[model samples]
Target: MNGGILHALLEFAFYYPLVMSLIWMSGGIIYFLRWERREPSRVRPRPLPDYPMVTLVVPCHNEGAQVRETIAHLASQQYPNFEIIAINDGSTDDTGAQLDQLMDQYPALRVIHMSSNQGKAMGLRAAALASRADFLVCGDGDALLDDYATHWMMMHMLESPRVAAVTGNPRIRNRSTLLGKLQVGEFSSIIGLIKRAQRVYGRIFTVSGVIACFRKSALHDVGYWNTDMVTEDIDVSWRLQMRHWEIRYEPNALCWILMPETVRGLWKQRLRWAQGGSEVLLRYTTRLFKWRQRRMWPVAFEYVMSLLWSYTMSVIILLWVLGCFMPLPPSLYVDTLLPQWHGVVLGAICLLQFLISLLVDRRYETRIGRNYYWMIWYPLVYWLLNTATSVVALPKAIMKRRGTRAIWVSPDRGLR
Candidate 1:
């Protein structure tokens, strides 16, 4: 009986990732053909009679060194009618002093100093409160926006009044280390491709936190960012979209941001993301079941299935480790962890899918082509790391006590 059950679970554990890979790859190809092949509309001039006033909010917490560069990038935006608002959310460092100095340099710069660390969502809320503009472009303290990114993102709002939010394409800024190169490939091949696919499906997991634009009216409609959610970006995206407001993906609005170079940093970053997703699943179960809230069914169902897959993988890993002491029937060979024919074929499919995506996104990114060799080894790295994170994060998400603030640790910015 144990053997039969083990075999069933083993088959699922091995085949499930392959199945998901095929689905994502196929969806990505179709999206590329239908959408990416066409020329982007950002280049065409709208020539607005009056450029709408925009408030660019940079929410900070202990970002003393990095925040200055970020503000400089914001100040240099090509758009004519926008202002930069720097909110120092009680940084222990010289961040408040730095912002004060910057305000003197940039005539349009405004500073908001919070008395204490209130977290990102709170800082953004404070900025929104002070803002009189209808359009708000919020970027993280660590990211640098392209000069025309603001203009491109704002165009979506101008073209469509229904658009509540716009997510920018975040490129990795640090590529001085091996881990950085791996992430460059990961973002271009996995993150960017998946987002395009989800958009083609009329659903996106989140409007990226690193950089996104939100309409003031839409923010009010959805109640703005949630302070308690581990990932406020993911939470806000769902909230606004659930209210039938549009969330757009503007690939042209590129923002260069830093990524983790160390294994510990990468693990913590992904764990937070996984935990946030799990928390959203837990919090929205009742609301998702409402008769009128049917549009979110697919995203909700996908999360549930992913959770089940995570749990199953965890159990199998534990049992396998235990079997190292007390021998059991092998799922594949029982004696060896060698790559079987099925594994090889699935791996080849993964490679093929990656190559296709690379070709599709070749125009957008420059250096990723040389990093393709590292991508071949990413599956082994990803499977072990992602599975471990899921196991740890799922429980954390479930047991999280209410009213606990979602403060964050500093992310590793690679070997800069």
Candidate 2:
């Protein structure tokens, strides 16, 4: 690469994140002021004129240790007129038996035993077909849903017929290790801010797969979740939006869940996420040029830019590593590897972004600031992890054949 080109790419690597941080910070603040401040019941569920029948769909695969607690939480929902449906997606463990025992305990609890392992998408499709309710709250088997979460999500669904889904806030439950602790900050500072900002930008890229409420009609209209997609949540989000349905983000709806504390586990999870995103972009980019799809233009464009940024960073890192072993052009050596004023500015911006997210999210999670010290490692650790995963996962996504069934097994749930 020429010296000028190297300088430009180095500038992009440093400034891209700074620019995005400002966007997220400003957009998140605007969203909170306009939409979140005036809510009447932020902590509890308010009585509605009528409580529509809803089904809580839980997809379980080898969740023997966690299913009991999850079901116990679901049975205690504050919302009225709701039932629990747990689908055992061919678990090799005791997940099926536990759900069967729970079925005997809670009259509202029902269990579906898949003879063989089908993917989460198939499990959800089966449950939706069996469900008698028009609205559905879907969550992971290991997740603990707040008693009032369904009520908050339902408020959005009931308010507008166009609202197809409402994604809840996911809080990390395990923070014993440094990795887990940093992830707590990550979810708040990075994921939470992006969702709020994207909502303000007029379309969400995807709903939280761990916790979200859906309208059955909207799912039907979009042909339900794509069974072959690596991440059904992302695929469904795009399809629903392309069909002109709306998806909202509900910060008040909280779901406490476990994350991968180990580096290998976290890498696997993020790689799947990145590949799913690439698959969605490749599948839908051609369709986004129409006038009706103008609203989604920003989302697609942002994702493309992010992919380019990831590759750019990866190349810089690779060149830097190579230079350490041998000689390189002076321009590449100085601009890419050495710290400068831009580095200081980037660090300051990261801190500001974390502070902004913590302030906006503290309403949902009290004591969120307790994790502030841990966020010091986020910029260095997560940026590299995400960049590497994006670079590696793109090729995998492209190579994946059509009509491949995306299956699942239980992931690392951190230390007990």
Candidate 3:
């Protein structure tokens, strides 16, 4: 009985990721052929009949270093009829002064200085309340919005009233370190592919927190951003979808954002992300059992299975470590730890997944292929890092006090 259970664990550990990779690949290919490839040019956003007034909300906390460049990029956007709103959420640095200086340079740029440090969710809510436009485009203070990104995202919003929000594509800008370089590929191969696949399947897991556009009406409908949620983006994505509002993935809406170059930064970022996801799952699990939420069943199931897979891998690792000190059964010792044909096949599939994603994404990101070599080793790195974080985050999610406001903190913006 013990051997049988161990075999099943090993099988799940090997095949679950393999199965998910294939699903993402097929769905991504289908989406490209059906929607993406049909577009005349991914480089340019299609011209619209009417340009709606859009307020670009930028919430900042100790981001003086990157704010100027971020605003500079937004000023160059191809989309017209838009205003810039920069919320200086109690920055200890000169972020307020910087925004004020930029306001003098750009007439349309508005600055809001909060007396105390408010979380991003509250900052966004405050921005939403103060916004003059019905349409709101929000991004990180450190992100460089592509010239055509606003136009691309707005096109989707204008196309249908049902589209409550449109998520932009985030491209990593800093690649000075090995960790940074791997993340470049990770975004294209793992994150980008997953978004495409999820979009094709009728629901996205979350929008890119770096850049996304939301309708003011929809924001009000869903109660704006949740102040207590660690990840406001993920929390809003679930709320909007649950209300029957559509959230779209717009690859043409590109934003250049920085990522963590150090191990500590990366671990912290992923831990928060994992915990946020777990919190959403726990919060919505009961609501999803109803007949009305049948579409969300697959997403919920996938998340649960991923959690189980992480625990299973943990068990395997624990047993392997124990085996180092004490004698173990021959069958268990030989079969559990070593990579056999299953590992070889899984590795091959991972490589294939990277190839397919890079090929599809190359037109939008011309230099993505340069990082392909780094991607070859991404599975090993990704598995260990993400699995560990997922395990650690689940308990944190469960124990977290509900309605507690999650404060904003200065994150590692990578090496300058």
Global Cα lDDT for candidate 1: 0.82
User: Native-vs-model 2 lDDT?
Assistant: 0.91
The digit string of per-residue lDDT tens for model 1 on 1-416 reads 77687678768767877877777787788877775567553354345555799999999888887988999999998888988888888788999999999888999899999898788998899899899799999999999998888887887898788999988888898888777887777887778777777777777889889889999999999888899989999899888878988887777788999889899888989999999998888888889889777878877887777777788877776775777778665652244345788679777977886787678666667556887888877877776788888878889998999778987566766678
List the RMSD of every prediction in angstroms. 2.2, 1.3, 1.3
| Steric collisions counted per model | 1, 0, 0
lDDT of 2 by residue, 318-412 (tens): 87888878898887674355556887888888889999988888778778899998888887788889999999999998999989999985688
Error of 2 at 370 (Å): 1.2
lDDT of 3 by residue, 328-379 (tens): 8865553356567988898899889999988988978877888988876787
> What range of 10 consecutive residues in model 1 has the weakest lDDT sum?
329-338
Q: What is the TM-score of each candidate against the true structure?
A: 0.94, 0.98, 0.98
Model 1, TM vs. native: 0.94
The Cα local distance difference test for each model comes to: 0.82, 0.91, 0.89
Top lDDT prediction, candidate number:
2
